[model samples]
Target: MTAADRSARLRGLIAPGLAALVCLAILVGLGVWQLARKGEKEALIARIIERSHAEPPAAPPPFADWDPKADEFRRVRAGGILLHDRETLVHGLAPGEPGRALQGYYVLTPLRREDGTTILINRGFVPTELKDPQSRAAGQVGGETSVTGMLRGSEVRTMFVPESDPARDAWFTREIPAIAAARGLTNVAPYLIEADATPNPGGWPRGGQLRVDLPNNHLQYAFTWFGIAACLVGVFSVFAWRRLHDPMEPGAA
Candidate 1:
């Protein structure tokens, strides 16, 4: 091709070429980020699994020494009395199998420890019908009792989740501060204890339903981003090839 024709073709490609370069860089960056997330998720899952299977400490650590990040998921024993009057039901959906989900609410009750400190205990799942304390009075263990459970941190609600209604005693998450305040509890711990699979007297509020099922789809996300980037490269290459091969416009050169 003549010099003028070649120059015109180069000018036509400048914007698209620049755009392709910038887009490719962004896509590659996203793919790299997803890969980093994958590694982080794997490590977190390993630590959680290890804590779940380890032997529980003889008793829960002192309230002064409590740290959610360091202490979460640690199995612990606590001797206390169940304050069933202040129980809260948090909305939840537990998986029954691979795809089936069982709609229910987790029963959270404050346990009054021997030292007078209180900690919220997620006694576990109960059907909607049994959510009312009166409906399951037989299961409520009054007076002093000892509980073995998994320590857990406060749960943050999802973006679209509705806020808890204290007036109606409806909760969407295990918000420690809110529940403690609403229940008029004092000297409450920042963390909660998910009671082990210990059966209640009436077999209503089943315990030991804790599941640490973290979604590890970061690898898939990384692949998707990488695949898009590859497709973009192929498309840009084909466009460049076509432009180069197309006959130059009729002109006096």
Candidate 2:
């Protein structure tokens, strides 16, 4: 090709070439970000397992020093009188037997401590039929009791989650502030507790509902992003080669 033809072809590629490079940078950045997120998630899981296995403290941390990131998934023992009448059922789906998944609600009852402070304890799952407190009478043991389980932060509602109604007691998300306000609870803890697998009195709402369902798919996502970036490079390479080879082609751009 002549020098003028070469210059014209280079000029034609400038805009589209810059756009492709920008896209490539974004794709590569996403892959790197995902790798970083994978590391964060791994560190979090390891921290949780280690803390969970350790002997739970005699009591949960004081409300004065509540840190969401540090306290997440930490196991702590709480002693209080389980106020069963103020129990809030959060709609959920859980594994019933081995392979069977059943629709149920997580029983979150306020436990009033001797200090007059209250904290929510997710007692565990019960089938749809036992939604009413009257149905699960035996499990409602009223008296001073203590529970050992993982301390959890308030859960955020997603797009798929339904609007929570306090009047109907229909909850889809574990919003601490909202629930406490609705139940007229005072001196409430900033976090809630998911009770361990220790069997309850009537075996109605099973305990140990703590499932670390953190999806570590960042590695897979990184690979996908990188794969897409590589494909884009190949496509741009071919397009450039064709345009430079055939400067007269109308579709080269």
Candidate 3:
């Protein structure tokens, strides 16, 4: 080809090649960002696993200052009586032996401690059929019980659904304050207690559903993002190559 023609073709290649390079760079940046997020998620999972497996920490002082960062998932021991009269049923579904069965509501009762404050206790899982207040009241094991469990934050309200109305004993969502008001509890702690794997006599609501499994699929997600970025790079490379070598090709021109 003539020098003038070659020069013109080279100039024509510059803009499209540069544009593809920019797109490829942006994709690579996004891939790197996703990889970083994956690393963060893995680290968080590790922290959760370590915390869950570690021996329960000593019980904090009653009404003592509780900080989420310092005390979340910390093992605590407390002696309190199960206020069965005020047990609030938290709706849940569990996988059963036979097809998907609605595992009854979580038995969340207030535990009145020696220090005059209340902590919501998730006694355990009960089948939906057995959620009658009368039956649960009848099944109450009297006397003060020593409870070991993990401390959990209260459930937050979502925008779509209306808040739970405790007066009517209706609970569509786990609004702690509303539930507390319905149950007539004062000075309720900001957190709930998930009972440990302790065997309740008579096999009632079984405790120990606090499976601390951390979902760490972030690495896979990061790889997927990176793969997309790699594909983008491949596409960009081909685009650049075509622009540089065959700028005047029928369709390309």
- Scored by TM-score, the top model is 2
Candidates 1 and 2, the one with greater lDDT: 2
Comparing 1 and 3 on lDDT, the stronger one: 1
Estimate, for each residue in 1-253, the C-alpha lDDT of model 2 and write its tens digit. Answer: 8988888888989999999999999999999999999999999988888987989985564476788898778888999899887888899998878998899899999999999999999999999999988888999977899899988889988999998998887899888989999999999999999899988989978998777666899999999999999999999999999888874766546
What does the lDDT come to for candidate 1? Answer: 0.86
Which candidate wins on lDDT? Answer: 2
**Every candidate's lDDT:** 0.86, 0.89, 0.73
The alpha-carbon deviation from the true structure for residue 185 of candidate 2, after best TM-score superposition, in angstroms, is: 0.4
What are the per-model numbers of colliding residue pairs? 0, 1, 1
- TM for candidate 3 is 0.77
The C-alpha TM-scores of every prediction are 0.88, 0.95, 0.77
lDDT of 2: 0.89
Residue 134 shift from truth in candidate 1, angstroms: 2.0
Residue pairs in clash, model 2? 196-208
Report residue 153 deviation for candidate 3 (angstroms). Answer: 1.2
lDDT per residue as tens, model 1, 165-230: 988888998999999999999989888999988899899688888877889999999999999999
Scored against the true structure, residue 69 in model 2 reaches a CA lDDT of 91
**Model 2 alpha-carbon drift over 4 Å, by segment:** 97-99, 251-253
- What TM-score would you give candidate 2 relative to the actual structure? 0.95
What shift in Å separates residue 230 of candidate 2 from its native position after superposition? 0.4
